[model samples]
Target: MTLPIVTAVDQAHAAPLRALIDGKAKPLGALGRLEDLAIQLGLIADGPPPTFERALLLVFAGDHGMTADGVSSYPASVTQAMVATFLAEKASANALAKAVRAELRVVDAGVDADLPAHPKLLDEKVRRGSRNAAVEPALTPEEVAEALERGVRIAREAAAEGFELLALGEMGIGNTASAALIMHRLAPAPLVECVGRGAGQDDEGLARKLAVLERAAARSAATDPLAVLAEFGGLEIAMMAGAVIGAASARIPVLVDGFIVSAAALAAIRIDPAVKDYCVFCHRSAERGHQRMLQSLEVEPFLDLGLRLGEGTGALLALPIMRAASRLLSDVASLDDVLNGRL
Candidate 1:
């Protein structure tokens, strides 16, 4: 099916953005990143800063075949176990979602195991797990399309349920490999620069992971991004791309998590660059490659807490900062009000 045409945010609101930021509430440009954030929000909303009433954190869980290569330190079963942890509210994402008052929705994008039915988990599994891209394609084109559709459906449902903002997250072992592939494809940097030690891999493990990805890239050299995604993209990444598109079409702010989510955002941007207008880079992840990815996107994230943990932890941490930015832009008194100089 043809995806809906997602429009970019209105640039015509620049004047109002300046008015809001330069209205003499504080020293000129003293609010720092918060000022820029308020302006960005104004532009995204096409007016003043929007009131984001409800936030939805959608965590897409999947499994990677490359984990069998001993490239990662963690066992492949960790992916499924982590999904279970998310379902049980025992994961970091769950804790952050609770703290931020955001509803967490975990989707089984393509876990290797058959997940038991749970009220909170959306069973949209496309496959048990992807094939090893080191040797062959990870997913078929049909599978990629299915995963993307599942993401779009979920985002639409969340928007309809009154979620004003959406935060993207992922739970998949070996996902950093998928993310590295995406970064290598989208960024100007080469694979070596985009790849990093995920989950604390030793130098040897990192070399093996890089070799596998380099081989994967070489095998898929003549392919486009969709083709590359079919070959190397995880179910979670594809689904996140779909959700980013869906949220942009719905005109909700899309708060992007760290590297993995950024990789999905890169895919979404490839699908439709206009989606960036609705995206907010939540923070700079501690992963070395994430810095290059953010530089490529030309976005300054809200925070930098030396965090490398995915699961939307950084993004959730950023919600309060966004809230504060909106409040300052909309609620704080102007200098004229304080000085009694207004008519």
Candidate 2:
């Protein structure tokens, strides 16, 4: 597949952004990571004046047949239910997006059940549900390719609609299991470490999840990002990876939520390393392997609310801070003006 071209973040703007940040009427680096965020937002604007004028959160939903193997404590039906809730504007992503004034868009990348037509939902289902990875490859190469194309189209459409930022979220019942496997191969971390208590797994449950993932892993030795995505069984994940590449190609910054979204970002970065430059790690998820995932990306997330939920909650929470960071560029008074009694 021909992936979209995503350029690395422009470094030419970094020095200017740093100077602007330091010139603010505050101690050097007093804002700490906020300064880093401002610089990143500025660089994403291609050295032009940065603006977080509008932001949109894209929550991609799917179902996993791997749940048949008991990898998750929850039933796959919950995926369909949550998609309905999101459409009703009552899901966590909906509330958080509203709280931060970011638009929310839910996409049905792939869910096992038939869903009612909703004006708000994007019908981009690649399949009802992925094939059980334990038995065989989850998605065919063509399915993966189509999912990616849809992702790119969705993100670019958002850009055209005038959203300045893109935030990612997911709602697949056993997606964390899929994410673990994706991270395991791409991070090259031991499978044991990548496995986590997705949606609250107990000791026995965690062990079972581990064993199930192990068997799935044994079925393939592919390390390529696209190959790994096809091997794993989550259409939402594959679509999110495409969205990441799409957002980067559009020269827009992306606020990545915890583990699952991060896994998608990982695959995206591997597909085109330049995509890394446009991603903004939102927070550290309480999910066990999230730290290693962030470590592998060499990024420090902004919040650590001990959140394990995966509806782009962390990303929405971080949006306000990013907006504030962008304001520092045009809202705050520079030291030159302050020292000259120019207020």
Candidate 3:
């Protein structure tokens, strides 16, 4: 697969951006994480006061056959159910998307059920659903390639529609299982370290989930990013990785949601390390493995309300924060301006 080239944010711009931020009409570092966020956003925009004409949250939906193995407390049907909820503007993500005035589009990546036509849903299903990873590779290399290509295309389409802020989120039953395994290989961490109580799992459920993942892990020794992804494939995750690469290639900022979405980010970062600079780890998911995912990437997330929702809900909440930080460039005044009474 030919990966997109993401040029790292020019360090040449970092110092000047920081100077501008420091010179803002406020105490040094008074903004705290907001300042850091502004700098990152500035670098992504390749200027101070990073601005995007529009923001779009791509909520990719799919199903995992592994859910049949009791990895999650919810049934696999919930993936399709949640997609409907999202389209009906009844999901938590929908409310938050509206709150931030962001457009939310639900894409069917590989949902098992044949979803009905919906104006809000984008039909980009690569397959009915990924194969059960515990028994065999969830996706062949070809399927992985197709999903990635589609993701890139989707992101490019959003960018073409004047969306500079691209956020990624996912809805897949038992997806946490897929993400944990992906992290196990990509992060090169112990399997236990990568496992988590997804969607509120009881102690017994967590153990059962871990056992199923162990079975899947033993089936592959793959450490390559794409290899691991195919082995423990979640179609939505693969597509999101492609979107991440595409966003970086376009020099746009990608606001990444929690665990499953972060797995895609990790995979994309592995494929192209430079892509990290363009990514905004938007939320700190309550999912335990999410911590390891962030630590492995050596990045800090912007918001942490102990949210474990995975439909880009956290990302929706983060959109306003991102907007405010980006506006620091044009909204706030420099100390010189304040002192000189330029305003």
Q: Which candidate should be chosen as best, given TM-score against the real structure?
A: 2
lDDT of each: 0.86, 0.91, 0.90
Q: Which is superior by lDDT, 1 or 2? A: 2
Model 2 regions lying over 4 Å from their true place: 48-50
Q: Give the Cα error of residue 275 in candidate 3, in Å.
A: 0.7
Candidates 2 and 3 compared by TM-score, better number: 2
Cα lDDT tens digits, model 3, 175-205, are 9999999999998689998899998899999
Structural similarity to truth (TM-score) of each candidate: 0.96, 0.98, 0.97
Stretches > 4 Å off in candidate 3: none
Each candidate's root-mean-square deviation in Å?
A: 1.6, 1.1, 1.2
**Tens-digit lDDT string for candidate 2 (240-317):** 999999998998989999999999999989988999989999999999899999999999999999999999999999
Candidate 1 vs. true structure, TM-score: 0.96
Question: Which ten residues in a row are the worst by lDDT in model 3?
Answer: 44-53
In model 2, the clashing pairs are none
**Ten contiguous residues minimizing lDDT sum, candidate 1:** 220-229
Candidate that beats the other on TM-score, 1 or 3, i.e. the better one:
3
